[model samples]
Target: MPNILNLQSLLGLAVIVGACWAVSENRRAFPWKLAIGAVLVQAALVLLVFGVPGSAVVLNAITGAVDGLATATRRGTQFIFGYLAGGEQPYVVQNQPALFVFAFEVLPLILVISALSALLWHWKILKWITRGFGLLFQRTMGLGGASALAVAANIFLGMIESPIVIRAYLDKLTRSEVFLMMVVGLATVAGSTMVAYATILGPVLPNAAGHVLVASIVSAPAGILLARIIIPETPGEGGAHADYDSDLKYDSAIDAIVKGTADGLMVVLNISAVLIVFVALVALVNVMLGGFWLFDGPVTVERVLGWLFAPVAWLIGVEWSEAGRAGWLLGVKLTLTEFVAFIELGNIPAGEMSERTRMLMTYAVCGFANIGSVGITVTGLSVLMPERRQMVLDMVWKALFAGFLATLMSAAVVGALPGAVFGT
Candidate 1:
């Protein structure tokens, strides 16, 4: 394993902060105290999850629970799709690699988790927990009420759904507050997609589910830090409307389930469609580039992306020799979706990279920060606050950079910790 107590990670952290400051809206008006507070909060979460005594026990339990949920989802899929969905085969196995179907075995988890998340929300179970975190963000990060609540809720909700938690206050937010909300939304993953990612990454990383959960949780503060650096809050901004009450509602548990299932269906179909098109396009691109040779091999998209982002990979604590592969994955995550990047990550052969590098890359790519998400965010936020649509469009690209840097900062934090914290 690579050295987890890497001093280069400290340099990476400084470079990230400096990069943000270099493009800051108001360089002289930096929120010094808020920046420190955000880093401290992320450090506390990292220690609690990976360093605290008996954290492994708690993490194992969480992982087991998530795995059990996946099992239950598989059972449902098997009933509907029969042998193709991981059920017993009538004939002898011929192609073991082709046995598992992504549509039948994996996508169903989105439906189940979405329904469960909706049910939990109706029970006010998640709402109260979200409120608790909202208050924490407000108090510790000194964010205005609505931004804090939205950031807190983004840990478990989708980018669009999170802002809906503070929908009523969207128009009331200052320019900086609105940008912060957008940054955090892109920096975190939604609960509905969390299990699917865990299932994909389970073979690559231990406690995969727990790591995905912690990635979202820790990225929130990093998002705040980066967003503040890019767009500092104006003096005497609005803070009186720190309400956490959400306008989202359902008539009953059954209604919530139905709505959630419908939403999940859209998500599943969208993912399926995107993957199909993107993968095909990539193949076509590779075919076009097949004639070109570089380093005594055919030049492909992965190689080009690897060369482009290798520095970023090294900056986030990957070894120089492995940085090319790591950079390709990072580039894919930024240009394509994280789902595609993760699928590629899972395809890498065992022993190809150190455990530390795998863990660092996991944190680095675990977010909704991609070119596609930019349109989704702009359209979603525009519908919620039409009056501020122009402002959102203007600042959203900056928010994307902030979100991207936020995940890298999370990876840098993980890299800075001692190897013993993770038992690597």
Candidate 2:
């Protein structure tokens, strides 16, 4: 079948966007022009990268680079962690399917990408790219320069470090603009984290890096649109671009690499700890819940979530048959973290879910919108703008919802994209 955007996808997009609009804070003042334009832009980018021949070639090359980087990361892991890191001359456990060595192989990529991102920033290449995108966002979205720049920085620096890019504008930003930035932060993953996810999902989805990148790009504008709807912009706000300052200056290239590596190490420890505790707690809860029987015997938290959110899964483009499983992954992502969700998605039984479901789930789970994020984003942004703490606290939950919708919007678009993009 030639991959074309069919009626099913168009309805899904409209339903999802309309749902967001329905619950908008000021529905009377919604931004109709921006919403339509953003969706059109998202559709064009999706078709271009996934459908257009010239663009797919470029996307494939980028995905190739990311895949090679993952391989390189494994090599580094082997050199440092030896057989435990999936080296040659491996023992039984070492050679096993990513069971024991999953963290060893995947988590370290955070460190590598962080250092690489820092190096790019130090050379101002990252700055130029982010600022250019910020400019586009500023003009296209009709957003304040500060918020747009921060949104662009989120592509690489993530929700936490991204606020630093617009630290100066935090105080001046109106309530609506602040919430929009928060929504964008939650909708996208940092470049470092994207590498981590790409490493895990590379085998499951074609062009993992490209999909993750596209997910962020598509969701960002959606986040802004959603935010605007939920809480319409106050009169006279988010107009004109502000002078951007990346606030990411490093003393030297080596300095960036070293600092970024150190930051990556901290993140690795953080991820390791979170996973250890979160997984254990989930098991404990499941044990209690497992006592109850469903048709399939003892039920676990995941199964319950699968059933509860199955409709959500289906609406995002998964088939009705696979909705439960996709919803399970979505639940894990929202409750635990996208990291744990992707790890679990990589382990799904082969042929249990269709290829399309797996690909859509990959896009759906590629953000930082969990409950854990609400506090992290609040604290991170608060460090720069303490005065906005009360306001951030007030809007945190709504931001999370907007972020979730934004990512799901991206997933629908990707799922609707013609499979021809992947040579399917």
Candidate 3:
């Protein structure tokens, strides 16, 4: 039997769409028809891609790519860790007391994956795919050309790099269009980071890489729908259709690899630094919260977050029993960053979370949609279009909400799926 109920999923969908509308300054001007169309198209894409037999070929192609990445990462790991790569003896003998040596040992894989993604982009592989997807968004969502391209590119590139595709249009884009770009950028994971996330969650979930990759693709339209609701586009004022005329110029394959390596190094360092600070801050908060001793028991940040967001999780179809835990992780992802949330999720005892709950959480926490991302998007966009700095700042909060709703939409779809389909 199908695990999803049409009415319930539809209601949850309405809540997300309505919430987006309610939060916008120009709520009365929302484009309900376009938003509905976008949602339907997204739903159709997910059903076709995941529900059909012929679609397996396309999925197989994606799986093959993921396997290639996993193989390369493993080989790179082996080169550094040698026979200790698997940590078989330490795990079996119980001699190593250290709980997080593997995290440090595998850190180099982040750089490797980032470099590989850069090479793929330079080779025009990712760009071709993104352009095709961009065209689809343009047709279905009626987005301005530059905005469509940026949203599509976001499926594969980082928040900053995707905007560079629409650099020429940045200054001319309307407030709504610019807000859509920022929201989409925050709503999806970059191709490079997807590989790193796969590695982080792989131990706990089957098909980890594929799920993360799929989540970003599925979230694109959701982002569009939410952005439209948050800041309705004024048809005559928005810029023309997007064109990614900016070719990724590289001298040679070797040159691409060298530059990509440097880019990846910066990303690795950034992730490491952010994680250290965020995790420590969470710990500090927990210590303070523990002192509360409400009801003669210690309260922690996790508990507070769980209480705050459990309703949202429940709205997305998580079981009541598991909603609090799922809510806590979602809150962490939104308030801090997805990287911090994933680390916590990864360390959670497997027995405490069901496969379905964890799967939903995986989709929920898959984006860079956090408080920090709002500033990143504004700064990045402002750099490309100095004249629009004020506009970017004006729409920052709208983009943040849109980005959050986009990820929630993705989780809602995942939650609505039959557990048998995803092997949950």
Candidate 4:
């Protein structure tokens, strides 16, 4: 981690931004102001949260709060899985292995967060925050009111849960708006899952919770900004609309809890299936790649994708020495899932990666932007708003690309800031 903000890094950032612009759905209508503005906002957030003393203190406080929440969440899991869930040891305190057991650990946070999100919405708290953030996004990025609300809500809600906030507006949304919704949904990870990721990476990255939280918040504006640039608003679309009042049709507190738990159950099952399938597929491909070894060693999908994305990682401030390592995570994240990428990142040995590279890569890889997410996004959103099912299918691939680019943009923005290097 060199402290210098050299010419190479500047060029890297420019190339990354240019690549994003080149892939715009309509290059002629690209929104440069929004793109630049969003990057600046993301940079400010990065500086304040990661750089400034006061802001870091506040963010640390929030991270500590989440740690407390995780502790409480662990209580429920401990009741169910006992020793496997890893709270108190059967004998004395010692190190615990990271558990991927669906029922024991990962899925419980989803269930808790889902129910908590419903309760917040039912209590009108989430509505107010969503409206406030929605208005802010609209003003900042020139997004439509409904689209702004949905994207803002996505900061704390799941892809499907967030869209449910704007369910009434889905039918009337323009193609650009629909695409924006899909991209933002795919670009950001859900809040409940953030807790799980933080729980997973907490061992390696101190402040893991804050970084994951910040990624979700900052990626919202970046996703909206990128989606607009990629697909500008059509003439006469509801780009001017800004109503934040959503029809939150929860029967009662108990009903919200029940429905949320049920939704989380279905999502847990889907996630379990996704992980099982992708892990097995990656192993199968690796086995084949292993049979055809190059002079250096056996080559696999990771090496191929890593070489492709190495420049992209370098473009976002990862040092050339560790660019491939960072890029490998990006490749894994995009091709498989962020979950797998995070697990790989967690597995990386201490000191093998510089602190700066690790932090930038964390920002880079923290998203739901993957190929498999395309199908999941379509399935989830279609069920939420069936009228847009065909439109969703049409723009699925484009949205996935937009989502990936948006996360890359987030990484780039954070990289551009002088304050992102740890221990500076």
Which numbered prediction scores highest in lDDT against the true structure? 1
Which candidate leads the pack in TM-score? 1
- TM per prediction: 0.97, 0.94, 0.91, 0.92
Candidate 2: list runs displaced more than 4 Å.
1-5, 90-95, 98-100
TM-score of 1: 0.97
By the lDDT metric, which is better: model 2 or model 4?
Answer: 2
Residue 48 displacement (Å), model 4: 3.5
Colliding residue pairs in candidate 3: 145-241, 145-242, 146-242
- Overlapping backbone residue pairs in candidate 3 total 3
Misplaced by over 4 Å in model 1 are 1-5
The true-versus-predicted C-alpha distance at residue 220 of model 1, in Å, is: 0.6
Q: Candidates 1 and 2: which is better by TM-score?
A: 1
**Model with the higher lDDT, candidate 3 or 4:** 4
Task: Please state the error at residue 297 of candidate 1 in Å.
Answer: 1.3
lDDT of 4 by residue, 48-138 (tens): 6777767767777877877777778789989987877875566864444544454576668878887887877888887798788888888
* Candidate 4: C-alpha RMSD after superposition: 2.6
Candidate 3 local lDDT, 228-269, one digit each (tens):
887777758885655567545577778878887887788778
Models ranked on TM-score: 1, 2, 4, 3
User: What TM-score does prediction 2 earn?
Assistant: 0.94
